[model samples]
Target: MKLLSRIDIRQLRILSSLLQERNLSRVADQLGVTQQAVSDQLKKLRETLDDRLFIRTSNGVIPTPYAESLQPKVEHILAALEDLLTPQTFDPRTVTRTLTLCSTDLEQIVILPKLLKILRREAPGVRLAVKKLELDQLSTSLLTGEVDLVISNPDFAPPSYPSLSLYPEHYACVASKANKTVRKQMTVEQIAQIPQVVVSPSRGDFSGAANSWFEQQGHPRNVVLSVPTFSAAKACIAESDICGFIPARLLPDARLRVIELDADVPGFEVIAVWHNRSSQDPLHQWLREQLLAVATTP
Candidate 1:
């Protein structure tokens, strides 16, 4: 407890500078502190955090995974400290900036309508840009402010980023109503026999989100098709004997019918994840509130 208390604001500033500058001497020079002073602080940070945090490279120093994770959080802490002196104020109607969101089609179909209504009625000048969800680019895009919020299931957010649960969602085993072979319910063994279609937008891989759960039940998923979008998967599944697990909210389609599983698939929470730098910013604050209102309302 005492060791952690030694991590004062100056050490945090040094940590941030070192993460960006990636050079001990350069960080020291930038912060107007001695190289030894920086090293002493780094040593303290390592002990307090219990992570090496950085390693010496030929060029200078590169942050370890633990250190990389801390970068955004440290910046947020610094930002919050800085915000204490500079007051922020804004009006929703007067705002004229576009907020970019990284999300999947599921969110676009389910959440965006309500959110757009609120935006149009309240913050008319605020434009919204939603890009396709790319999980690999999530950390970098958010850190650089290329994306404001990532609306997806909980698994996609980086460990350090802040997130709010927009809504709860569960999957439904769906197939074409035309699939006569399957019925209203199927056991794990029965469902495993059928070839399934999956949605993998960013990659051309056979891997799926629920494959492991199926495998745990002693039936490795036999994925016969992988499509880029839910609509594509739906079209394919609706026509063929193949099936998929899709969100329940997108159902009741004339072409599709639900296939109940005895052992239900676990649900996921759709969250709006954002970098912490926007924590105190009024635009993000107001926008998150509006999103929460729309998502949580019955």
Candidate 2:
């Protein structure tokens, strides 16, 4: 059977590291190997690949076209291998580590406040980094450990990672008090006839199940404005006659009134996701528990 040996893997890894650091000595130090060992590996790599992968210069080694071409594939393979070998176990009480989370702005505004408070009291040393992640990259981001957890609407397909439903949030049609067109309640037909604002993170089009509900009810709303965030939609609603659908939990402010939809629109299920390998991790488990607790609170 044809096989790339483990030594080949090690050599590729070393080559990739050297390309990144641009200094053989630094790469050698990181790898805990002598500079001669790195040079010997580089020589074997050049023989195996039959190309001058790197050109030595006065400053440092510069990658040849061949080396540049191999960088991405090598990095991906190395990342995948590293992910495979990463320890899944974690101890929250003993471990002082940062957990990276990917979530939407609405979720960050609504959920993270309480979660941060709890974390500060419970795990004082642990840190958190929250990044806005677009829906298209959610699955791969979780799989690759780009983010430890993703809090997203469960309507989107559950990522390859292990996921659990946090809570259900219903859609509400919101309008400013000054807008005389919509009152406390809006029928499906009435809502469809009004100028609407749509919120979508990816396409900036109608969001969640709103489009599906409109189509199912045989009435499509005319979307006058499209924005990338729920807050933008709410702002549009507050500024004009345009009404938009948003999560029910986002109703703390008095600038807009959330009206119930006459048509049966499906509620959004919020989910917390983590890599399958991290399902048993104590830190991940604690984070999930804290998030779930915050979600459950009235």
- Using all chains and alpha carbons, the TM-scores for the candidates as numbered come to 0.73, 0.74
Residue-level lDDT of model 1, residues 62-133, one tens digit each, is 999999998778877788887786456678988889999988888888789999998899899999999998
Candidate 2 on 93-156: residue-level lDDT in tens?
5668888998877789889999999888888888999997577877766654668898887655
lDDT of 2: 0.79
> By TM-score, how accurate is candidate 1?
0.73
Task: For model 1, state the Cα shift of residue 271 in Å.
Answer: 1.1
Model 2: lowest-lDDT 10 consecutive positions = 1-10
